[model samples]
Target chain A: MERDDIIEYSLDTHHDEEAGKKIRKKIYFVTVLLSVVTAIEVAMGIIWGKAHIDVDGMGWLTIKSIFIILTLLKAGYIVMVFMHLGDERKSLRNVILIPYVLFIGYLFFILLVESSFIFYVKDVIGWV
Target chain B: MAGEATKAIDQAELWGGGRSPFSVSYGKMMMWFFLISDALTFGGFLSALAFARHHLEDAWPVTENIFFHFPLTHAHLPLLYVALMTFILIISSVTMVLAVEAGHRMDRKGVVKWMAFTVLGGAIFVGSQAWEWMTFIAGPDGLLSTSADNASLTSNPYGPQLYADFFFFITGFHGTHVLSGVVINLIVLIRSMQGWYDERGHYEMVEKVGLYWHFIDLVWVFVFTFFYLI
Candidate 1:
């Protein structure tokens, strides 16, 4: 008898070795991509440290932005490829990712802006 | 009878019942929902860290100075150890994916092998974190303890007190997740060996656990970036 669970959810995954090889290739590609991005991030951190520049300067800010961007790139690969969300149906993907993008984006904005304001307040109060 | 029941239902109803709207199993759907909530929790912690880092201004310690030690070496490496930990977690993620792939093919032996590696990687990562905490709280000069009478939370020689607090809290939280992931992996690995999925005639359990495993790795990426890298 055909298992209804498998049929209903369409568990008809890549079953053969030929299809497995293609999936393996994609896995290797994503692994390398994540590693390279991580290496580049570390390299940037080292180079920035060696520069002996002002931590609060515009240059530091630019580098921080780069770090955030690269981190997001790494996150994208992990979520899409490693998590296999990329292969999942679009409805599932939307249900999972939409809230995160919107909520986290708003949270970061509000918190960071308020953080700077707090810093200013602490500065006035001679508080570290 | 159920096949007839399914056929009797309107196919285009979408949510008219007798159908999965997301085209995934119910367990998988619930897993995704759980992961969404978990992501927000981690998001709150990391963003709060960011908030405090900025709130303290120049009082925040440069992470390099705080975390420069490497194992078995006196040389100052600066974030190198954390970098290694990141690679370990990523490699485990790869192994978890491989295991999931093997499950899809119903290659029982392949699933067991890859799951073993995944569990090992997670154990190593958590152990490394413990070692890191040891070194972190016991600094080069003296105790890095923020709780000692000599240095309380309000004042500490190692930059701001919030620095150590957040370091412990955020990374500690991530470490707990990794630890649990390892346990879950071990259970799944043993079950895979005992032919549990084989008896069930499907390996959706492996895929579900794989999703959770990948989410753990995903969280680590964010933690490494926010906690160590930047």
Candidate 2:
């Protein structure tokens, strides 16, 4: 009786037609958007490389920065939209996502400090 | 007739039931917990990758040159393979959703058919990933060289060590997840065909597996952007 009851319970909760359709549509839209954005990023890379556009006297850095920003934007969209985290309860979403954001931010800080230290050491001391 | 009987049984079990401390279904709750832990694992990997990229002293490989390689033509094209990967994953998610819908209708045959397609899609995606990995690890033209005299990292004509490292780590992690997902789907698919869930009359397993499959596809979206586009 217990095993049969559990199996019945599983069957009752298994099917979700409406929700499935909605999620499918959402996934398709997000996929199209991701593909389009990828194409744009690649095109931008090509144009930036070819034009040799100098933004505030930083050519490669400006291009790289723009690329990074766009990539991060796409990543955020994927997490929020396709993952359905955007629709989840704000509290629950924050609980799962906030720590990740903070940790990644902390990582960036460490990278910046360490990279600067390395630059100073190499440039000042003539050390490779 | 059986549907009504099943509903009555559920109500009896719910209201006449001894209270279970956990209100939510076990499988659904477990899926959520799994996703949370998986999120943290991916976050840690990405952060470590960023750290490595920061400390490396060389230009990161441009995504266009490294990943954009065209097979058989020797032409470097960007985003094409990743775009294909994205489509494969997205289509698989769609099929999984369809399977869930079939499960809802108690259309056992529908569930089996859709699930088989979903498994095929997953297998294809993994194969594509394996090909991508081969391209990455072998380097272009099979030659690995270091850029600077002091640099210990091996690189090729395509890019830098940091690029190769992150490419391998991030994509490899995601690929492993996809492989596991395929296995899970296979199990569910076999069970569905075996009338295991059919007799019980609920396709919640399909929904649960769908959730996991969709999550993998979702993660790939971010990975494609960060590792290939950026």
Candidate 3:
């Protein structure tokens, strides 16, 4: 019969003081990294606000690309560290991430190609 | 007997059937799967926004102008308040990871303390969102008959009606997630306090709740980039 006090696994079995310290250190490091990236994003927004949107050019696209890259970097760190996805097996990581990369890339590809279907392409029919 | 022995060998060579192939708890695996589906759902929302933005091009509302209001002051401080919210969410994510780590050590009090901080951070973020929505509704007035900064599902003074619609839908959906996350964290915090998981011999529930919470924060990073920054 199982007793009320029986803990199947010992309370101290998984506890490693060194591991705990490392985890805490990693948490603080990731937190600061995310904050710094966000601050950079905000600074870019302030610098480009009202000025860039009103004037349409390649510069706006460049700034946007920067934002997207930074955002993805932040997402990667969060998933790997905060959610412990990094600790999972290689097969598990691939199974989870591959679909997202393939599908989301396809979505954005159509976003560039198909979404502008109405616009004039010089190859198709120029001079509206 | 030979056929049965061969079939058992095939099973052993492939999946093994006894241990998890993923090397994670069944519940954690389920949470990961659920988050995958949810991420796709959010991808749809953001992609829809992208479609509209591309179609409208320059006519699209500049995010900085539309969301520039800061509370209790007349200053037009674009992206500052939203940035504050982002930092709060990130810091809370740190506290959540700390709580899960504490659970690993079976330090119940540590779990409780950090979980309380996480809960408070989530509540403040949700409250900040509410203020933002209210400010969005009571938008700017005057300057043009097309009006200044007001927004509604049908009307928008800034750019197009589509702007208001997408804003409401994307941020609204994410805010709903945050609200639900807050509620879930509160429930988990109470259970941790009550020694519910200690009796079960594991604090796996905290870990599960933590995965959900971090997922919420993860989605917010995307929303902030796609909606506001880009």
Q: Which candidate achieves the best DockQ against the true structure?
A: 1
- Model 3 residue B62 distance off true place after TM-score fit, in angstroms: 1.1
For model 2, the DockQ equals 0.23
The digit string of per-residue lDDT tens for model 2 on B51-147 reads 5555553455556665676556666566677777877887787677667767777889998998999999999999999887767666665443442
Off by over 4 Å in 3: A1-13, A53-55, A121-128, B1-17, B142-150
lDDT accuracy of residue B219 in candidate 3: 92
Candidate 2 clashes between residue pairs 3 or more apart in a chain or in different chains: A11-B202, A14-B203, A14-B204, B68-B77
Instruction: Give the worst 10-residue stretch by lDDT in candidate 3 chain A.
Output: A2-11
Q: Candidate 3: global Cα-lDDT?
A: 0.81
By the lDDT metric, which is better: model 2 or model 3?
Answer: 3
True contacts kept of each: 0.60, 0.26, 0.60
How many clashes show up per model?
0, 4, 0
Better of 1 and 3 by lDDT: 1
Model 3 DockQ, alpha carbons vs. true complex: 0.36
TM-score of each: 0.89, 0.72, 0.87
Q: Residue B141 error for model 2, in Å?
A: 2.3
Runs with alpha carbons beyond 4 Å of true place in candidate 1: A1-10, A124-128, B1-16, B142-156
Docking tier of model 2: it is acceptable
Give all candidates' CA lDDT scores. Answer: 0.82, 0.68, 0.81
